[model samples]
Target chain A: MLRVDVEKQLGEFSLHATFSSEGRVTGLFGASGAGKSSLINMIAGLLRPDRGTIVIDGETVDDTASGIHVPTWRRRIGYVFQDARLFPHLNVAQNLDYGRRMNRLAPDAAQRARVVELLDIGALLDRRPGKLSGGERQRVALGRALLSKPRLLLLDEPLGALDEARKLEILPYLVRLRDEANVPMVYVSHDAAELRQLATQIVMLRQGRVTSFGGVKVLT
Target chain B: MLDISPAEWTAILLSLRVAIIATLVATPFGIALAWLLARRDFWGKSVLDAVVHLPLVLPPVVTGYLLLLTFGRRGLVGGFLADHLGIVFAFRWTGAALACGVMSFPLLVRPMRLSIEAIDRRLEQAAETLGAAPFKVFFTVTLPLALPGVLAGMVLGFAKAIGEFGATITFVSNIPGETQTISSAIYSLIQTPDGDAAAGRLVIVSIVLALGALIAAEWFAHRATQRLHGN
Candidate 1:
């Protein structure tokens, strides 16, 4: 369960967005500067809304009335940036292990092995991020995000940087993550094709608010 | 005839030791300051920016005097350290390092700030959603993305420390093998008619050291950028 009703003003642009969903994958489709990223940032707790409330898994993550705002790191939410910002200093293996190490829980080697196999990135473990190709980098980024075992995932244009071939290669992995991983996710994108393959629900935005939000079958 | 005296070699070694220590001591501080300037906006930001760059703009003597007032033996903080911890810093090699670190801190911080600012903030937000604490994101995402700048800053700081003279000499004085450094050595040599050859050798060494640092910075920045973009 992910709910957001955030209003923030970034300079001249006023972001007033409200939405709620429990879907496995919810796509937020909007043009550049339409406040899509801003709304996403609010959910991530990186940007504070002037007023609103966000609840995830029945817990109020952000609420102005109660003055409760969870910091981004403690939100149990995962976000994937458009450019796949993998750590340059860390190799592919360390990059994947970062979230796990940070979770501070006892090491779950069996679960770790499953994610490694699911992502099919075991072979690229020893290589540095600089050595991987565009598609491989995105996969490593995806694997890194999943290894954290997020309760909710936020992907902000994860495919925006790749070329056509790279997109094709990584699209299947995202689809698998959505369908099989079963984690609730918020995906922001402008490309119709990507939404077609990955999004289960579509939340369209124009200006700074949601224009329409419904099952992807409507857009399809 | 022997090329140099034992005192001369000690000065050389002392200079090297002080500069290295200064840089090492300031590296973490430089990164933290850079992160603050780049990521957060708060009250008196402009004042902080100016204060950090004070050593770059003020005369070395002035900077040294200020350091002496704050960190000199029997000085404010220095007095406390001397009284309680028995740590002495007046006219010592440690004092030289303090001066060098202060003088070169801006060099270490500016590049880091620029690189940190250049990084996409969205990635950090993404890490946050993935259950990364602020410190973890800093170490994993923010710091990694800003590595090029941090590396460049460190190299520049090290270079600046190596070349530093004014504040070092003013703060610790030219104490022969205790506080003398490359630039101080060169300055002392130039004062005498027969010391030209030694000064020239140190000059060549300076150039070589600076050139090497620049080359290494370039290689590191390139490799880091490639690794980040997964190129």
Candidate 2:
């Protein structure tokens, strides 16, 4: 479960969002500049909330009153940005292995092989990120995030950077991820259709406020 | 034909030693300062940046004099170091290295800072979310990406240290074998009546070293550009 009640002031806009979701995939649905990214960023611990608390999996990751703010790395979360920010110096295999090495987790060849096969990225392992196509890069990014064994996965417009054909190419993989992966996810997108297909619950936002919250029907 | 005598060879070897030692010693401090300048915004940031670049604009002789006062025998830091650690920098090869390091620092830091600045900060955030702490992110992501620039900086610094004349001469007084580098040696040779031939040979050596360093720096810069482009 994820709980968030946070207030932040950014220039002229103010964000006072409050919601809690027990859904396996909570789709944060909103238009551009509607604070969708900001809300998810707060959950990922990338952006600190000026006020209130965020609890992920019974752990209070952030609480302004108690001054409990867990840093991002310690949050044990995975984030996939719109731009696939792969390390240029590393090949795909190394990139996938990075988080495991950093976390000092014992090498799990089984899990690595499973994720690679799931994403169909085995052939691309030796290639540099620069060699991958747009869809291929997103798949690699997704695989990289999954291999970290995060408690929660936050994807901000993962498809936002892709073209229509590329989006079609990756949506099936995402659906498989939702059904197969044990980790809960917070998928943020402005596309209602995409949310309708994936989100078990929807939190609708407009101008930095949660205007509505419910099942996929709320997207309409 | 290059007919270099033993005295000239000593100066050449001394120059290489001073330059190498200076470059190696200053690199860690240079990388730290470069990262600080590139990735941070804090109080006194501009002031720190200006201080890092001070050697480039300040007269080398003035920098040397300041070093002498601060690190000379009987001076503040020098006195403490000598008394406690038995390390001395006054009128010695080590003093020449110190001077060269200071003189070459700005050149060493610029490329590193620029490369660090060029990195996509979002990538660092990605690393953090992937369970790498801030320092881990630096070692794994930021430093590797900025390696070409680091190499460029080191080459530039090494070249500058090798050719450093004014500050080195002022700080260590151009003592042969102890402090006289190629630049100082050439200075001495050119001043003597029959030393023109030796000076010419040393000048040729200097030109070759400078050209080689320039080429290496250029190559590193090219690699830096490619790395940034993710190619």
CAPRI quality band, candidate 1: medium
> What proportion of the real contacts between chains A and B does each prediction keep?
0.76, 0.76
lDDT of 1 at A115: 72
Candidate 2 residues B76-178, lDDT tens each? 9999999999999999999999999999999999999999999999899999999999999999999999999999999999999999999988889988889
Error of 2 at B125 (Å): 0.4
* Per-model TM against the reference: 0.83, 0.98
lDDT of candidate 1 over B92-197, digit per residue (tens) = 8899999999999998898889888877776676566667777878987888778888888888888888889988888888877778888888899899899888
- Model 2, C-alpha of A37: deviation from truth (Å): 0.6
Residue ranges of candidate 2 with Cα displaced over 4 Å: none
Question: What is the model-wide C-alpha lDDT for candidate 1?
Answer: 0.83
Per-residue lDDT of A85-150 in model 2, one digit per residue for the tens?
988889999999988888889999999998999999999999888888989989999999998899
- Backbone clashes counted, model 1: 5
Q: Give the distance in Å from residue A153's predicted Cα in candidate 2 to where it truly belongs.
A: 0.7
What lDDT does candidate 1 reach at residue A117? 79
